[model samples]
Target: MIGKFLNRINELSMLRDNWNYEGAKPIHATVCRQAKALVVRLSENILKSLVVFPDVDGTLLFDVRSDNSHSTIFVCDNFFSYILKKKSGNNEVFSGCSWNKDSDVNAMISKIEDSLS
Candidate 1:
């Protein structure tokens, strides 16, 4: 279902301003591109329960939940932020920028894998 996630991300881009009935901004094109890139980097296992959507602030949001954990990754124009909640009640929260770099993408991939495990 990675395809499903990607499709949803694309759908989110069609949302208009105030789509949420609360004056929310539409999803930014840059944010959608960044989100799709991140999704493409995900492993199938981590993609299993992943859901992609947009936030009111024009960023993309990715959420994945396993039996013992839950995580969220927010994608903006050139950066990403994530919150990983572990089964043991510990949480990992961080943000990184610079989508033009391979290292940043790799770091996000690694963090996502850890969150899902």
Candidate 2:
């Protein structure tokens, strides 16, 4: 479960870093795995530092500070078992990433289309 999360986060960071050389702005990325969540503070299209929770729980945490001290985001995220099982609230939003524990540590993350009010 965590391997995928790390890979995805790394992938995002790498993507941001790649964009950096070309003059793209850096973006923040948060990842959660086994109560160990990580928040990376990026600057000028590069990863500046990180904030990690070695022991934490719950869903959807965000870091709003400019320094990115320690907070969580409304990621609209949670965990479930499999494709056959669905127990989500109708009004809830999903981030479109699923981890198949039964299978390889591989996880699939998708870009979520959120409705802005």
Candidate 3:
């Protein structure tokens, strides 16, 4: 599962780079929405597989910020339950979340990287 997530992430990153090389001004909203959904879906699955309690209730929200230089993916549950942020050229950061469990956060990060293989 983690492998799949990383593959998708890599694919998107490459796509974005290609678009930039082509001198594209901005990415389309639909594409962004789709990408955000995929991230949320994969995150949710990771959370579930870990048996993390208070499972997400299908209320994941994505806060995307991007400019000519960089992009960010912020995922959170409704009511700010949990927030995960991944920025261009940086590792994923767990800003805050309702879980607030260090072990869970560490495990999640590990899982995400595990998929990279």
Candidate 4:
């Protein structure tokens, strides 16, 4: 069943795209990490998506995770997650956000890269 949401439509589309990717068609338009962080450029916005499946309320909404057993925190309604994701510049783990072109962007980029390493 569909739980809570910040951006469900985008999430649904990404799931479809990833499913297609698993079938070997390989839609190179979007990118999704093994840890479930994803970024897809739609129109003029780079849409980032995080998994918060089947959750109604917690920290998992703000932090990146592969599990769906936690709460789905909608940041548009969550000032805390908004601040955290904004500061992190890597909201690719969440359902929605506006991009910031600043030093924080660089820092977040570095953080994600370091996670990869």
Candidate 5:
């Protein structure tokens, strides 16, 4: 179970690394929102599969750190948000919201799978 959870985290990290949104502002925002939602869902599922306690809510916090940057995915309260800071400076590069639909989340997952090849 731990392995499966780690694999999912790795998959999400890979997706984050390979996500390239060169489109318009609205499109980029949509993609980012979807990706954040997917990350939250994946984290929640992993915690649910691992924890035995039924009331173990708010105790688990999953964060995915970037390998090449100061970006991070923070999962909380059934939502996930991404914060990206500049590599050379202490400034934020981008920050995404924390809401997305099921279809958007699934689409983001599909895009990640497609990037794996």
Candidate 6:
């Protein structure tokens, strides 16, 4: 699974500018590096629930879904934003956060993991 994740991320690097046919930016190198590092750190359970994709803006997205909830982490050059939706229809958003801040990222990951569990 980790191999699959790494392969998908690496494949993003092959995308050229305007790959979306709408003047979309190519995948940013920093975003891909950060995303690969993140994927390596994630637990197997979380990885199993994850979906990785790139946005037209050259950012990376990690989407995790469970039967009762969904969470998304949007990764930019040096930071990330998270959105979480619960079974009860509650939505929470956290934006303009740095990925270098381990505490913030860890807390978000833990919350998502716990909710999914």
Which model scores highest in lDDT? 6
> In candidate 3, which residue ranges exceed 4 Å CA deviation?
17-117
Candidate 2 clashes between residue pairs 3 or more apart in a chain or in different chains: 26-45, 61-72, 61-73, 62-71, 62-72, 62-73, 63-71, 63-72
Q: Estimate each model's TM-score.
A: 0.90, 0.24, 0.24, 0.25, 0.31, 0.94
In the range 31-100, model 1's lDDT, one tens digit per residue, is: 9888887888889988987888779999888888898788888888977778888888888887775688
Alpha-carbon shift of residue 78 in model 4 (angstroms): 8.8
Candidate with maximal TM-score:
6
RMSD (Cα, Å) of model 2: 15.4
Lowest-scoring 10 consecutive residues by lDDT in candidate 6? 108-117
Q: Rate the local accuracy (lDDT) of all candidates.
A: 0.84, 0.28, 0.37, 0.29, 0.36, 0.88
Of 5 and 6, the candidate ahead on lDDT is 6
**lDDT (C-alpha) at residue 75 in model 4:** 28
Candidate 2 regions exceeding 4 Å error are 17-24, 29-89, 93-117
Ordered by lDDT, highest first, the candidates read 6, 1, 3, 5, 4, 2
* TM-score, cand. 1 vs. native: 0.90
- TM accuracy, model 5: 0.31
Backbone clashes for every candidate come to 0, 8, 3, 0, 0, 0
Better of 1 and 5 by lDDT: 1
For model 1, which pairs clash?
Answer: none
Q: For model 2, what is the error of residue 75's alpha carbon versus the real structure, in angstroms, after optimal superposition?
A: 4.1
Runs in model 6 lying further than 4 Å from the true structure = none
Q: Compute the lDDT for candidate 2.
A: 0.28
Ranking by TM-score: 6, 1, 5, 4, 3, 2
Would you list the clashing residue pairs of candidate 5? none
